[model samples]
Target chain A: MTPETARRKMTGTWSAHSPLTDVPAAVDTELAAFFRARHADYDDIDPVVADAVGALELFVTGGGKRLRPVFAWAGLRAALEGGGGSLTAPTGPGDVLRAVSSLEFIQACALIHDDIIDQSDTRRGRPTTHRRFSALHSERGWTGDPARYGESQAILVGDLSFSWADDMFADSGVDAAALTRARQPWRKMRTEVIAGQMLDIALENSGSEDPGAALKVDVYKTAAYTVERPLHLGAALGDADARTVSLLRKVGREIGVAFQLEDDHLGVFGDPAVTGKESGDDLRSGKRTWLLMCALDRADRSDPAAASRLRTGIGAVETDAEIDELRQIIVDSGAAEQNSARVRELTSDAVDTLRSCHLASPFVDELVALAEQLTERRS
Target chain B: MTPETARRKMTGTWSAHSPLTDVPAAVDTELAAFFRARHADYDDIDPVVADAVGALELFVTGGGKRLRPVFAWAGLRAALEGGGGSLTAPTGPGDVLRAVSSLEFIQACALIHDDIIDQSDTRRGRPTTHRRFSALHSERGWTGDPARYGESQAILVGDLSFSWADDMFADSGVDAAALTRARQPWRKMRTEVIAGQMLDIALENSGSEDPGAALKVDVYKTAAYTVERPLHLGAALGDADARTVSLLRKVGREIGVAFQLEDDHLGVFGDPAVTGKESGDDLRSGKRTWLLMCALDRADRSDPAAASRLRTGIGAVETDAEIDELRQIIVDSGAAEQNSARVRELTSDAVDTLRSCHLASPFVDELVALAEQLTERRS
Candidate 1:
């Protein structure tokens, strides 16, 4: 089928409802197939090796929004249907899907390593990889420190995911020329995200109270990696011109920043049942996030004593009462409300950009819905 | 120049001395050039990131035998001048050099992660990456757990190396078809080494007493990744046929095993001044090396009490007297002698295979000399 006709038919199927509903399953299906092939290849080597791969597979298929892939697909669709360029739709949607699925592996790498750094016990309501392996050591009556063993295994597993992510991207069945084009953004994304992560660690280590520091971390760690680069990659795959890539990047950055701001809000105040994370988990870990910075800023300006209490309680092991007090302090300081206002403004700006861009009407609408969903959702 | 004439000139430069002496400088030069470009690219992003990259540079250039790259270059040389094939000398030696240097980055990744796993304080007479960073945290009086912050930085640094390794390989300026061929061994090497590392961890955790278990670890962890796969990668880059690749693999595997066996002996018995490692480090860490397995086996057959004593002494924070006793037991058990004999035998077999193969004469000679240098070394 012609690119336009195929897209039209697909759009028709989604015309009655939101496109976000189908994305998770589609991305999961692609990842599952990839893991099946990996399992077969590795199983032939040794069951032990297969098990390592299996652990990673479980982590990948377990839970995620699959937002990066969705953004990538929308970017490609926008590039193809927007009409002012010679760039055409990818001949094989399967290849694009596989290529985009690599983003999830990158996420897996980040989360696995992040969990270790945070010393987190659970994620998505399941035992973190290191914790799971640590428990295995204890159950099996293994020697050495179980924590060390678990941490080591998790590190290797994270390394494996990183390697496999690259392999998947390279072997995505895209033509060589297109693959080369996609690599610029891909390489930058990997480097920038890691650098961003390093910056976060550095900020936390230094106990910096600078608000600008947190925003820089957010831009590199969340904004570029989660959205801007993925969209740029997709545009590259579609052979989009510079102007189109620039436009998508602007939209992606605003939405990504808004998404992370909402996350910061949820991290402190959302219900554990809904968010799948314990409320105040980030505060407990003493992450130097934008929300924490904003809270500190406001508290310092209005109530010095409240700011002192917040500082003392932020990075410590806190009881339920202390957590509630800190929450109150943040709320009373007006940081939460201000943060929410920024999210709304950024979401609105992203939607406006999407609407004003020369992208296809259907893609623009879907993107607008996605922005709203991201900014407004509890989780 | 013709392939033969180029081979003649290159061989003449090395006729008076060992090839190993020149390899380190050549590989480092290539690596230095690569890092310079990377620094320029990353420095534009953030000085902090530039500093992180700088740390990796220090780690890479600090000290290493550069064995993998040496083996890769030898394999390429053997392929180019081996009489039976249409394969010629690489038109650009610079490309092969850069490609070979990528092995160093992979080694850096392994070392960084291994330091974290082993909780090692120093390597090659310097503090390990994690320890270095941890010390930095203390010096700076950073908040939170200094150890965690250091470890987190090291993990990201390792990740950066892994990513950069792939980028270097892809951009090595080799023809794309040759690179595609090289990638097969490259991918397998990465996966197998990680699997081998996991096996080592499992064996340590399970407290496996079986000598064969350690040997299996050595084969996968050391032999394949360090030698066989690197040679295969080089041969592939040279477009060598399957028979030549197989020959190199066989030669590499035997020599690689010998290399690790020697390393194990050095870990326990060699003078700290010579080995640059505190003697008994492997024992202290309870690494499941073949030497330890052999010692246990011999001790079990002759003296059960000695075996028991050896078991107790291993994996403990021992006094100097205990370490001395352990050394005596290892020597008295005849395990150390037997292990040395095995190394000699393996090295001989590797040389025999290299001589029998229809490879270039000078390269074969160098390979034989390298095997001797690897196995007969004191450290």
Candidate 2:
């Protein structure tokens, strides 16, 4: 097993009852149909928008498991049953589905723009939209650089996705009150995430940024929005009260932070094949990740070599040895172990919340187990 | 006045009226304070966003008529006058003021993104965000082309503006129903414009595009969203009934078309200084405008020179003689006069709608005047 996965301290409460195995099948079916329906009107006029719609369909279908949406669904379904959502009928499955898709769309937009913003050529082992369009631009001999055109088009496509998401959610048949409830967290998740993204840009650009600041950015930017809030959003929609909702929020916040810490751990010292990404790319890109920041804070500036490597190793495409050395510094400074504890603490807290959530369904056991696996699984 | 202005037709029974001058001052006071308060949190966070906030403040301060929000406020005040709004209440002004600001924020985001996407170097004679950032990017010696980076950052900045608009709307004092009504049209406007932008790109690239097809694209893309929708949207929130709304839609569509046709005329044949643009810029850029399209449809195959000029003139920096010749070709070909009649007819249709509308307010008169000026004004 890779050392990155081995370091996790997973103590999941999920037993054998979780339905996560069924998630992928459901997500794929809905995605395909949703895409086809959204694109049906493309030919009415503006073939360029049609072209963009085509591009969106192609990109969304390319890769990545629909993990978040499924989790949201599970959380919501569990909430409904616990509250006898049958009798209340506050909202329906359609609204939940629409919300989940909106989240997925949001994820898609983020990834597309992130790819351009980061200038990565490949995503999921395939050419990114920018690269694909850049080649097309060159072949077509369009004005300016194809890469620039690609970036421009990709930016617009992401915006289209974002706007469409709002449209879809607004048009959904979910009980208005329930939809409103779900919307509260959904909106917060987006705002917090965007703010986090801005912070990320700031962290990378500023030389003064270090581990503590990076950690806070990670929580707001990645963890809370990615894992915790999706869970909290689902639970809230299912009518989880203030107390239970509060527990979920705390649980989500803790786990979300821990999850990103794990992601940070993997980024620097991971196997390319297993991770489907190059090891140390993050360090090379000079991301002000929590680990790098921590190492920077702890490093002895008296050693000019270490400081130079840490600062320059990021963003260098060819300095493999320097990247390895930086990884060593991260480990040596004990950031990895500290983050591991953070993960464990968060997982335990989440389990503690579940234990008191008044869950009657067997899915609760699965969620508990899945939460443990998220932090503990050796990938 | 040009023949176009003299021939300006009535659009609907919806007559144009001068906007109440008092509205702009009220809008300015509230918007300035609202923006300042929102950015008041910036002292503790990244100063870049704070600076962006400041730039936005300056931008809105020097904005065009706060027509969209004014309409919204007018509608809300009109709607609530006899219904729910308490004119004597202490918080009434504050509440309505915030609602107007939310509308302003949406417009602000739209304009910012529009400038970046259009890649025009100036806005109201000032250098654009993309240009300012391009200069900054070049000075910083960052990776990638400076202009491209400038565009990228500007898009993100606009996105931040847009997301902030959503949050502001959510928290606005207007009722959820008002927000809901406003939200659908807002989304539609965004979609139509983006689609229109795509159509613009497609037409630019089309080797066989006709003038009629090109004009159709221009109409759908900018005219409807920018002019007509705002007027109707404002009324929708207040006293606009179904027939009134329908009538406004027809007026907006007709006036929108005329406005775009005029813009097309200006792009190809207008004075550089008056337009704050270069002459025949569209021709040099190979833009497929209505005038060129009309010329294409009417070009005499027997006159080899006319056809040749049409081809070579595209993308050519024309000389004064060439400009005169091209202008003659457009005028002599009957394209200008024909399209001018279209503008007149659209205005007539909008004026005609006034008779059909089920509701009437001062906004109808104000909207008509703006439409007439927008469609037929020389500069």
Candidate 3:
């Protein structure tokens, strides 16, 4: 994503609501109330746990686009909306609402667990839980290995939240059949999120040390979990026929790839202030993104020594000059341009799928707009 | 615990089931088929994951007391059994059976996650998932770090199992109101188990670092999570009133302490081969169990230098003669006998709670018996 892509000042968001105006507020209210209820006496918990869980409460309720929850409601509504022949629900909204809310919890669990595994120190400008706890452990001179203990505690916190999220969604109003139907995508969401996480880790770790494994990591790690599953889940609930589901997955394929492309672009070119991330952070970490993948391919034919330099911590803070060198290598290899074209092609293909669905529903336009904007977002 | 405790095994394992001995076989058939159907494609999965998942299928189907499920079934029967000498069930046995099977899944989730958090490499002589994956990680040149990736995957796998377990029970038809009542305790069970996991971590990490925080960790971690929550969940499903729930918690208090005490004792005195653990590992690890707490208290008064020596892990994995000297110091401190006596008092008190409940159900005896056996077992 370049500054040119960020030029759309009135950039619109796509949501499942029949009219986009009402979606954000409704999602906020529903999700805020759900958090309020779960943490009604949040401070009254065991003192040791109170502070940590409170931090989580703040992280969740702080703010986001509410895209995940909106997709859930829209998906459910899309499924049952026509069954009632209006932009209203046919079934009681309790179970679906609970189910949708549970995804937010799922998101929270993932973020926490992800932070711990990544050894990331801050999230959304606050210290990560393991870092926070390890700091506390140091101050206290805790008995066992502080780092290991901190990691263990973080693991428990993540696991606890994971279980609570499921229990919350197990509402009685959702009949067995509806639940069983709904659970297929639900199953994939869990499995794929985890699979994607593995790939992300593998690509970072594997280097010229093992190039083949790193590429596979990119597919399973990012493309499938983050975008593909979320869209499929929405379609599944929207009463999609097999054709519609297939198209939706294709839509996911394009958006998911482009989403990663935009991410990689932002990693190098975007402003740290706007992204609320340090500049060159991914480069410092030596991530094997799509841009890197293409560069490696080009280097296999030419400039093998240059590719070797790109394999190690060429992006580390200590190697400041290497950042520019690394960026140039990516661009000069023609990998950057190739991936840029791929992004455009995928986004165009996704738009075609939306058109071919041929539904007269006015929401189709917004979906198409979303796919286009998604690939082009600067941050 | 000693062989004297394990030797007094209660003999009438299935005597009470003579009236309907057919029930066990029926339950076994249903459960076995469930595993076979669910895991029919086990051979097709990654050998390691296939083995991890397959282990659960085998273990669940393998004989344990099945005491938890049996209690659930009996309670459902007792609650719904015909009141006026009718032969037909007030509720179908299948309904109770399904609910009971769900409880088994919950138990499995607890055991698997516990093994990961505890870093225990084996369960009943088989390698744990982390250990298996740790070994596999060594074989594969997985990109950055395979053990970290493996642990994360194991956590996710446990999470998947836990969610699936909750789903199995979510739609179980024990009547809408009954499920509604079960919801609170069931929800609490999830929360408490997590809180307890935190407490366990805290206790293990406490050492002599933070004296003030140590005591609270002891009370909240094991006592509340392990002993208390399981009983509460069982009683809630059995339709126990608030007074009974409170009573059950008190029973948990007594039993949980004894359970931990017995655990500490086994960690010391139990044979390595029979217990499937190296004896005195706690002492070697410098774990601050109650026995160690008692020893420290004694040494502080009688011989200051001895306390320091004990804390240093002086004889931890040392020559046998050095270990004997350390063992003698612990004996001179009289920590073992004191902790054992406490276990005796608490175990007796836990049994007394059942006696006074006056429920006059066979479940009361079995539960009491289970508690006693758990606290007394040598291996």
Candidate 4:
């Protein structure tokens, strides 16, 4: 079979209506090749260094939705739809794939650092990097505090991933001119994401009862980073016009926020088996997410005691019963309904924007389908 | 005075013999302008993020030897001397200065993360970034574990510095073509440094009694990162030919290793007034330095009991008396003398290499003087 036909065959086996089609497989293939090359390089370094590289490779390849790269590829395809003959097509598929796949390294950096911040024990049903390294210390009966050793190693590993991201992006085999075009959005994405993460940490500590505050965090930390900026990077690489880039940004922001809202909902309410995360994980961590903020807002209006409980419960060590009670308050206070309504509204807005863009037919259809999958998924 | 004459004047009065002269000030000026711009951007984002940015700015500006940037500038100057007019001069002094100054940010990233791993309380006579952030958590009475919060914030701060380093280096006003030339060494420096850091962490935990292991870590972690790669990067930016770059790399490696050996001596034996660090701090932290390794090896030969004691004492929590005992073993075993001799040999070898390179007169003289200062300094 031809490459395109083989790709279709691989993706076709997924559920009949999946919008991602061959994108996830293609991205994974790119990432796998990238890691294989890196592993070879590290193997020549030393066993210990090689082990650190292996950990990073495992974390990056183990499990992820490949959402950012998917969005980037979709953006590239959408931009190519318009007959702007002035803008040259990307020289080869390999370059575009390499460029987009670099997003996974950025994501790995964020997740590794985030796990440390959240003191998370597991990610994607596996030990977090810090925890894994901590276990290594224990297994070896090494000197010093095992916990500190693990955390330190994880920090270095995360840093290596950050450096590798830039290296891979710059070396992505894209022409120099196209790489230059992609740099601005890449830089912006990095700065904004870190700033957004800082805001998340600060707000979680502040215990502020402001929904807008949480939404701002979502916009900066999630919306721009998870979707909008990646799309912009792809559009830039594709040499899209300013107007098209702006339009893609709008659609991406709406969908990205909607995606995160769904995540918040699932964090507290979704089945552990389905979500692959413990129920109420966010509530336990006291993450200042919009869903929790909406619940607190409703609690203040009608149930001061519930609001007070939430205020005290946040960032506090909580029992299973307390977690359930917090979940109950969110559902009982109409906050859950409000959050769901917002998700629907944002997702619809995103679809409408995409429709108005008059992008190429099948790719636009895929984007709209992807939007629905993002906002309405159970896991 | 004219610009050239003004520069000469600035270099003329520095203790009559200091090799660095005005390079530190020039680098600091470039860094200050960069931070000023970043602080403005962060201030617009949020107060908390602004505070993080302020902390980073203070750390970068606070105090450092500026060795990496100095060496880079010296390399640039030396490369320019070989009138292989094929190699272009930098566009302007501003661009070259900015590019070199970006090295400071990389140093900051390393120090911040190193401080966290070592659980260091102070840096440059101020609370380290993690400690400072921890204090903020406690002062604000924020809920949850304050130490973890502090460490998490510091991790993000370090990551931000890493990102800013790349961003600043890219926007350093260097011509794009020249910047491209520099990217490979820049990338190599990042990867090697982190790999070296990993090796350091691993060896420290392994309880391995191998001096070779410690030296290996020093070569990767300190030597190449602190000197060789920066010199290579500067030479690349100057568009030096392969031979010139390789020659500089050898000089850099020798001097870098010697510099770290001196640092190892200073960490244990230097006066607090001069070093700004408590004596025996390395012993207390159980750092597996070359000095300590030499002491262990000598102890094995002449005093097995002392060797056993040193092994047991290395990673143990130590009181003042215990630290003193550890320090005595290192000195009494003649490890201190051995380490010093190694430093002398390496420094002499480095100077000999520089002598043979036939670099431009004044710049080569400065490099030789710098090598002596690095190896002979008490602090």
Best by TM-score: 4
lDDT of 2 by residue, A1-379 (tens): 1222222212321221225554444445456667787777555665667778878777776656566665666557566546333313644454566566567777777788778777888887777776876776677766555665676677777777777766666665555566667767776677667667656654554455456678768887777777767877777667765655665567667767777777777788877767766778687676777777666665655455665566666667456777677777767766667767777887888888776776664766777777777677544
- Each model's DockQ? 0.69, 0.31, 0.38, 0.72
Per-residue CA lDDT of model 4 for B1-379, tens digit only, reads: 2354346546643221224456787677678889888887768888888889999998999967899888877667666766131234446655766888899988899999999998888877799999999999999988667788788889999999999999888878777787788888898899999999988988878887788889989898988998999888878877777888888899899899999999988888888889877767788777888888889889999999988899888767468788888888888999999999999999999898777776766777888998899999988
lDDT at residue B122 of model 1 (Cα atoms): 83
Worst 10 residues of 1 chain B by lDDT: B12-21
Query: Per-residue CA lDDT of candidate 1, range B311-372, in tens?
Result: 88798846778888988999999999999999989998888877887887777877788889
Q: What's the candidate order when arranged by decreasing lDDT? A: 4, 1, 2, 3
In order, the interface RMSDs are 1.0, 3.2, 3.3, 1.0
Q: What digit string (tens of lDDT, one per residue) describes model 2 on residues B94-212?
A: 45446555666656666776677566788888877767767765676655567756665566666666666666655656565655666656766667766776666555544544776
Q: Regarding DockQ, does 1 or 2 come out ahead? A: 1
- As for candidate 3, its clashing pairs are A79-A238, A196-A221, A205-B143, A205-B144, A206-B143, A284-A315
- Give a tens-digit lDDT track for model 3, residues A5-53: 2232124322234333344454445556665766664335565566456
Q: Relative to the unseen true structure, what is the C-alpha lDDT of residue B226 in candidate 2, on a scale of 0 to 100?
A: 61
User: Per-residue lDDT for A168-201 in model 1, tens only?
Assistant: 8777776667777787888888998999999888
Model 4's DockQ score:
0.72
Candidate 4 lDDT, tens digit per residue, A217-259? 9998999998999989988888877888888899899998999
Name model 4 segments beyond 4 Å from true.
A1-20, A83-90, A309-325, B1-20, B83-90, B312-328
